[model samples]
Target: MITKNTNLFVVSNVTNLRSRVNKLYIPKTKSLLPLFEIVSNSIHAIFEKREIEDNYQGKIIIKLIRNGDESTLKELDFIDKYPVKSFEVSDNGIGLNRENFISFQEFDSEKKAKIGGKGIGRLVCLKLFSKMVVESIYTENGKFYSRNFEYKKNIKEGFDKYENPESEKTITGTTVILENFEIEYQKKAPKDLLDIARQIITHFQLYFIEKVIPEIIIRNQNDEEVNLLNLFKSEFESEILDDTFNIGNYEFKVYITKSFNSLSHKILYCAHERTVKDEGLSKYIEDLRYIIKDNDSLLGYHYQVFVLSKLLNEKVNEERTNFHFSDDEEGDSESDDDITLARIRRETLLKVEELLSSFLSKTRKEKVEQYIPIIQSEFPNYASVIEFNRDKVEKIPAGLTPKELDVKLYEIESEWKLEVKIEGIKLLDEKKDITSLEDYKKLYDKFWSEFNEVGKTDLARYVVHRRSVIDMLDKLIKWDSNQRFYNEDIIHSLFFPIKEDKDTVIHEKQNLWLLDERLTFNNLLASDKTFNQIRQLNSNSTDRIDLIIRQEEIFDKATLFSEDKFPNDSFTIVEFKKPYRNDYVLGDPKKDPVRQVRKYINEIIDKEIKSEGRSIEADKTTPFYCYIIADITSTLEYILREEMFTKMPDNIGYFRFYTSDELKYKAYVEVIPFKKVIKNAKERNKVLFDKLNIS
Candidate 1:
């Protein structure tokens, strides 16, 4: 019978244990966390025993239970082990005494608070397993006692048939049977013995580093036993470097070690001797993206850094999966500076980089050596920037592709330019004090050095652009798979855009320099435009010239066609024919390119040309230079011969001088093949390309 007190209310236990379990978050990948928790409890119990008895040795045995079906065994053709069903962990430590029994019955108990126990490991166990059964024996007041209990979800009191001190027991130990692994979690759990052992080692690696781990053994149904202590010593043990750092008032201890089994360098955050969070070291130090290989032994290794601090222990959530603080520094309050995980990690990585300085320096040097040639041959624009900023280049990660390297070098160059700009401004500042004549001279010289280097980089970029244009022109003139050549408009647009004039297209957008460097300084230029459309010509005829240029003494548009224009002002008419085109009809002004140029020049001389109603200063003595760019086919060669044009000494082109009696002027004409254009352009830019060391 139960008696009711006069109190208005009383503290009550949770009614629905399943709802409590559902509230906890357990990721599928972390299905083994339940097993780790039970093992951690056993380890803590052993620590409790050691405190009482000095000579006592701690030992734990984990038994694996698997499904024994003949059909399932036959179906697994390659697997030697069956799927595990449950696990039974036994520890010869202080069993559940009366005080511990009371603590176990309550939720959120603080009995094991000194050892970092959150009093919810058993709840975590029920998340994966269907039931938990415990049997233990302990001595109280010089007398041996026994306890037995079974925890299941369906039980109203969370446990059934609780027997305390029911009968006498000889020894003291506890065996927890976590039975009936749920199918959802069992599929995610590791099936192999070695894999399971590795998970345990990784989880409790901090304990192993502290030399406080106990003797743990894993046994399968086949009686195969694995001593975890031996596994740690042979495979995971290494020379460890221990150090300490501080973030604000919180102190942190770090343990750095090398492991052959690690695929990449890692940083693990620990709280209460258990790793709660981890991040790849490559996220901070890119050189550690892959394992570090040893030349002498041909073995690859990577670092495993463990960080422990009291603040981390206090901030650890009840699930021990993460901390209460934010992961990013910005997520925390501005008044509290060092409470975020990112802040702690940044400081910790600084120490890690300091400790691995020698290894990192060697690897960085090798990376820079491999990258120098790539910049010289493929990215000449960054050569000077990289040479001056070697320290920034060393900070870049290794194993980058050409495209990635281009982006990194571009970023570095932009930063260097900004620095140079800032320095130049400071040097010319009126408020800056002139300490001495030598100091001022030194500052001025340094500023000019960086400024000149920037200028050289811009020039190199322009040279590279020229090389690309030359290559494109060479490819455009080649025959296609269909045995046909590119049309005239395609080639015409390469030098100057069709239907556009100098007023619409800037000099930088046109490649007129490929034909003649002097053409780039034209006072007026037009492509694919009729005589009537030109502002400098007053002719009403609609004959479209392929390309036309007019040069004057002064480059002012107002004086381009004024009466003050120089007598030496000249006119250039260029015509483009399809590559390898042999369909030329002699004396047909439309078909014959030479006659076409002559007709356009005759109209220009006959017209009353003026700018803003001012008489043009041109006379019959003004020179006319005409060019026809096309391949020297058989039919075109005959046409050139009939025009009295003499072949060039190289036999690649033809040139002639024609005297016009009606106009009283002399005209120079040339028929240049496509090959000669590419060859001459390359010859003109060879010196610059050689200086930049580019192909």
Candidate 2:
């Protein structure tokens, strides 16, 4: 069963061969990665032939066999529809001579070590297929020799050979037949010619560009051929750079290019001019695009980044799909040396990514800058619209697609035209020359209504700003440190002034907005200075009230709900207390928070407190809103329970009280704890802050 002339190299213990090769990893996406291994050897064999015959032209043909099972045959009318059965690769290279067969017998052979070859390409084929048939012819010792054999897992371990000095022929080549595709590898194969062709072009782009690689032809059962050289020629018309850079002891040559064909932006990693890894850099470029603008219209150019380094081969994993960790950083050793090397490797990769990121962003911006002047000169108003959109852009605003831009361009044109007309109308003389008062009022009302929407926007922004301030104030309530706290005056200064020196500076600025935000809309007559301390105090003056809020007819701020809006007639009286001031909560009838607000109401109802000749009037026929802010102490809780304030309604703070008559004078009493107010403000304000995308 064996020929004496050809070397019948027997691998010692075939099971050991299987066990050894099985340890090598093969990734799922690269089931057909064996094609690279097979072709690479063919290229090497071709080079061997070139050493003897310099004019030799290497040629490799790859053919795929389709399945003819009944299920697969049912789609006879379909094109390129059959599931793949096998692959055959034939190369006009120096055949599998004695030297080659010798190298194949060794484990981790170093014969091609200098050229970055591991001499284990056969494992890739064995992993993906059930069988291989090798046939080759070559001149050895001036004799024509041929070796032919059926290769299969767990089968005969050696090849059969035939030879004769008189049988020299004109042709010398090797044919490697791969059949019986493993079941797991079937689905990942690209059945379409274009798809597989693109994969090959992407995988072997660096090879085609740098080396005189053999002319590779791929064909299926349909007999369509894709020429690798022509494919590369069509796409790789330009090269941006071919330069070397160093990282540590490893020198890496990087090649960049712009493609006019079906090439994605990728950084291809190669070992000895053969691709070892590749990854598309689109995601990294996308990061830069998002930082520049949220708009989706910013598409960077199609480019390629190829890098070759012996370090790739030096650091390859068992699978060769990934690089291994640096020597000092392997396994689970807790040595400081491991940590240092690991950190260095990680930082090195990150630095490389950073460099690529800078290059992509600069190139993309330069490409887009060319069109800026043309866009601005022809569409000035649209330019303004773009700037406005950019100004209002949040951290993650929705990006604009082409269709959205088409719609937005029309909206921008119409809005700016309306703005031009409004400016024209403001130049009209009809306001001063109106013959009737009703016409003047009509014009005023029309303009005012148009301006009112701007007020609504301002109101929304006010809510957001106030919420931010409240969120900051929340940290102060339980702000105890080393048994220390903000004294009563420090917390009081945030709402209303505590010290007399700050009275002039803090006037009308009431930051304590616990009752409702609308309570802030009212005008302030006096705060802390008290009704009695005024320059011209009337008979109704009372020093007990901490704050006397005045509601005038119209003001700069908007009023919402029934409290601050409509009628605008009530006088809001407030009594703020330091939460630590438990003396105010004592049952000594005069010190109760409830009794204090009622006293202010009686003073306002009994007499007119005039401020600079403007009489602040309140009586049983006038409304008085009394608000009391203090700790919800035990004594106050008992008083609230006793006063039947337990059945208080919703949206109302806590307790309800009427001064003499409910129709004329009203007061809502809420004894709030500092902790509750701080927690509520933190919760509510967090929502607003998150909505605005603030950190």
Candidate 3:
């Protein structure tokens, strides 16, 4: 089937130039990357010339071209500057000779591989600029020649080579004019000359640090020029540290400088003497969240950290914008032994901390001192935790709010508790056969100490809760700016939630101790519940009571036995009236709290008491106690007189006993003001509060 003339098919490698350009990732924020690439190339070109001539000095000129209707722009008073349309970068270096021209035509050329060239920076330029034109004059074999070309994205060959007349001029140089800046990229690019200079200096900081940088200048439309070298020297202070470290068989060099003009602490990763990635130092070291002030000079400055490594240079992507390494160790499977960006950052950060130890120590000490009072006064529960974890506490960052500090301390405490628990479990699991007496005693002492610490932590938490409740009560009793007091329902819910009974609300959820500590030891308690809803009372009445308590003998288990077996039952009822309310109508049970309690007592006495399907004790002979909590208004005083109540010596309350033969019951009633209740509670818990240093 094959003959000598049988045509042989040829397969050529096909590449979609447009698709390749589209594959490049250039964020709007990095719109100036294309310009940086051009500058980098110019630097490389200048370096190439230095190899040929020992006394050659490199010079690069960047001229900004702008577009605007001069007449119209003059008429607009708000127009300060015209929009940039293009840029022309001229460099005095090895121009595009025959070998350079061939390299330029080849895609991903390796001609400049020895100098860390990716050979794809030109393509990156096309991502932002629509057109590129190159004009160069160079010498080959001592003969002056000229090469001119125009590059376009839509062209098949990517550019058109133009023939230029041989130049008799002696100066050799290259000029690349990038035209038609894309609107999207133009919006993100820096227009100010100072900003442009700063960007260039930041991108090429490594060369500046090494003192091998050329003289680079940026000129505006009005011929105003800024020398980048001078700008760098004025804005960046002396180098702070120059060090090297190894990461997994790779050596990385870190150069740190104190920058007087930087907005924040920055860490720039460089590859091939060009910055590839930048991150804020605050992301790792919290103390660097803002500009730091030197203690000796009292000048504010931020650090500019530059890191260079051969591994990074070799791992740079084709676009030269980023590297192939993962940012975190956890993202890579071989991170245990292999190098990662995060590991490099960790190593550098350790060095940074070591260099700035004095500053960090002072900052931490001041921050901890500022936080101590907050913990002692409002957050006493964390006092012990912070004391034990002093070293960890000193590492906490500054400028955290009280709430944020509380959350962080809570995390530290939880971690400590977990560690203690684990250690205690391990100790308990060990066998005692091989343990010496002294060792056993030491272990036992340690165990007991930690055990007591756990108890103290629990107690501290409970005491903190109590203090908060007391503080809340103190504020609740005060009048607002409007001269209005909180309603009775608001204060009632603070002591015990409304519309709930013992079956629905747990004992711990109620702050019954605020009223009377003995009330906390109740057999049954209900708040804002209807008589029909109480399980122990056999009544169809829907009258709701503010609060009701039933108590039996302390040793009696009422739930396990019949109610009749515990005849020594006592009942208590509490009613809360609106604070400072003087509207009281006697003889109307609905408006008078005393009559209301009487009505509830009579109804309960008439109803049989039962528990767990067992008939129980009668309540007529039981001793009943009632409390009327309200301010001693004039109308309330008149009502108290009518009820034959005697005022206490303090003149803030009244008490009386009611014995009705017809009702066959004896009851004691007390009318106490809200102020008195708060005062008594505070006095009772003052000693405990003092011990905890809480006010």
Candidate 4:
């Protein structure tokens, strides 16, 4: 029997009734956000597995299985006058015992002051369901104790008179069942439940991949495991990250061993699979704007930060260094101590927010905007903002010339000066001319030549120039193609490592790679034909090849070709270096020159093989021959030689280097056959240079 009066504190023989009851409460506005609270709390519990028990493994399983039993739904309809759809979730995790259970009841308590601090996850159930039934079998001094949560007609009376059940079994897990879920206000049942589950799995992929290796098997009425990850090939991920990052008080790590597809518009996950995108970023900005306005009086790093990234195995726990000491340490000074603690916690939170902001910003800048959709698909509340004070900030014009655009874009976005960032790109949809090969060539030649030198030259400035050129070209290409700049496979293919391929062959007719997705050489061949038409007539020896450089080694070596002339009758090997320093060339040629040159040669060979797959005869080898040509000449003679013959790499070789200066000289002086200069020059050059009038 239970009784309640004016002094409504209920009493029982239970050791921690006050604590347990304090842990349970109804949230002010129970919504989807509250569900996040529950999962976050569970994640915290999993994180503490090591601290709480020996041989503890970080594992937490949350299974939501819809109930088929019509009795419960019908019974509630008849008696409670409420339609209910219930779910049962079970996990084989360390259970919450009496003391912890009591703390669970407390409001805003810091018993477990980790990610789930403030003890609000339990309230999530209140938001999701009209009725909840929670059962826990945990140890109480070697004896087993059980607890139950039953809904009462009056919520206040129910809370005051909650009861405990007696049990003999000592199990180490808790189960929660929720019923009568509804969508009210901004809270609604997800249109796609499976998608919701997939998003959860994806956002927390690194977590499952590292610790729990969760097996999320969805089944139909037949009870067969359906692979949600496999069903969505676009969302299928086979590659994983090994990279890790460390901040002052946090060690961040991410991986992607498991895969899942998200159908929800955009849901934020603490352990995320990808970075948030523009749509999500826009939402985040709106939310933050509202928050800032609502709390106008609050200042000094007081903000709510939402983290959405693939930081799965990152652990954030309280540490000894969290406490700081001041010079004055004389007395108890209780108020001072409290103030210091509060300040430390506040700072910690601020640091976390800063890290998240930095990560999302970096990702947005470095990656393609198409990927932005994927991120936005996962997290809807991570938006970008260009904070402006109309009184202090000035609007800049966009019609600025390339040089001016580069300078102005930098000035506006630089951290020290104007914080000018382009967030959520929105451009007018218009058709433009197909990008001209001449324009592409001019853009490449102008910027890359300056970027080749590092350490000794103005590398930073050169790189900035290269980046400007790339951005310009990228935009132009996208405009011409009528597509987002990054969506073009050609753009990403140019930068990312190329996957190996077969079946590509060289045809005598085209002089270009026969059929390979990765090789852009074919396009270059076609473009050359168009560009050749408008060129001024020049002797065959005067034929010129223009190149864009990207690394310091190239610039350092760029002048080397001035010392050597091109070998007669050999294919020229043009190498483009990876982005590196440019201001000053490093003097230690022995260390980086060989390694860097090797990489360049390997890329050339890889492209060649991928492009000319089966063209070479199986038996008759025609002593493959080629020449080494680069804007730079930092590689030593031995390195160049090794790269040249290099056993022919099973295709083509017997190559030599012609310094850019030598090639330039040859362009003006030599009267050699244009056919002899570039491979397949006879036919392809007509297509490439006929318009240029080279005779």
Show how many residue pairs clash in every candidate, following the order shown. 0, 0, 0, 55
What are the per-residue Cα lDDT tens digits for candidate 3 across 541-571? Answer: 8998999887656634454235765456677
Kindly report which residue pairs in candidate 2 clash with one another.
Answer: none
**Superposed model 3: Cα runs more than 4 Å off:** 1-38, 46-145, 148-201, 207-238, 242-284, 293-301, 304-317, 320-352, 391-397, 400-404, 430-464, 521-524, 533-539, 550-572, 608-625, 657-668
| Model 3 quality (TM-score) | 0.70
Residue-level lDDT tens digits of model 4 in 1-695: 34332123233332333344445554434234444444544555444444667775543434333334544433332222222244454444455555566567564546744332555555555545665566665555566555555532235433433445556665565666555564451233342345555555554454444444333343322232344444333453443323343433444442223222222222222332223221222232322221221245442121222232222223222321122334332233335323232232333334433444553354334333432343233221111212222211123332344445335434533532222112101111334353898865654453343223212123333333233333443343333545333332332233222221112222211211211111223222111111122122111222122211111122223332233642211122222222221222333433333233333323333332211232211111111112222112333333445534232232222233323432211111111111122232234334322322221
Error of 1 at 486 (Å): 3.3
- The order of the candidates by TM-score, greatest first, is 1, 3, 2, 4
Compared with the true structure, what per-residue lDDT tens digits does model 2 show for residues 337-455? 33332343333334445555555555445543543453343323244344433322111113444345435554654564466458548846444767989977875775554445334
User: Model 1 Cα displacement at 245 (Å)?
Assistant: 4.3
Weakest ten-residue segment in model 2 by summed lDDT: 389-398
The order by descending lDDT is 1, 3, 2, 4
What digit string (tens of lDDT, one per residue) describes model 1 on residues 26-76? 877878877887888788778878889889999999987777763554454
TM-scores for all predictions: 0.72, 0.48, 0.70, 0.35
Global fold similarity of model 1 (TM-score): 0.72
Better of 1 and 2 by lDDT: 1
